[model samples]
Target: MALLVEVHVPLTPTPGLPPGEYPFPWIEQVEDFLVDLEEEGAAESCDEGTTFGDYFVFFLVGATEAGLLAASSRVAALKGVPAGSFALVTDTEAPEMGTGRRVGLPL
Candidate 1:
């Protein structure tokens, strides 16, 4: 019933913003969203993944498919979030699924 939501956020500097500005403000928004998810019993765990030079990845577990999609959409609508920002929805318990390959289309 729960799904894995993989969030990929770009860390590139936004034009017209101050130096060293965080390109994606949606990250905080997503964190807040996760809090709501927890309150609603839709989130089991959330973890910040290793950050590469240009982007960062985070994982969320125990989210309903609809909830994850809605949260991802909200993050994509936030200001200062780059176009590269996206979320991958995956069903880890689905039959015929590969070994660690549950990424869905970008959100």
Candidate 2:
């Protein structure tokens, strides 16, 4: 199963670091976590980007439920993380279809 792991952060984040630095701590935090998880094969694919003008969204795939929970916990525990900065894990599988164009497709 695939999961979309989202990490939302401020537009201009300065977590645990001063301003004017590249690779902001918040971004580095998630990337570092993914790097470790990737070594363990807990995560295989990820797409990180910004959104809503107030957030940096991370879309991850191939993570187990427990793995995602662990990652979320880590993100939640980071120092200097803003209140609005949070993590969310969701299943990425397509929903079962009972109508529309999916009605006639083979399972």
- Give me the candidate number with maximum TM-score: 1
Q: List the residue pairs that clash in candidate 2.
A: none
Give the poorly placed runs of model 2, Cα more than 4 Å off: 15-19, 93-107
Per-residue lDDT of 42 in model 2:
68
Local distance difference test values of all predictions, in order: 0.60, 0.55
Residue-level lDDT of model 1, residues 1-107, one tens digit each, is 55776666777656776777766555676567667767877654465554655666666676566776666555556666666766666655545222233333244
Q: Write the per-residue lDDT of candidate 2 for residues 7-64, one digit (tens) a residue.
A: 5566665654656666456666766766776787766446555564566665556767
Error of 1 at 39 (Å): 3.8
lDDT of 2 at 21: 69
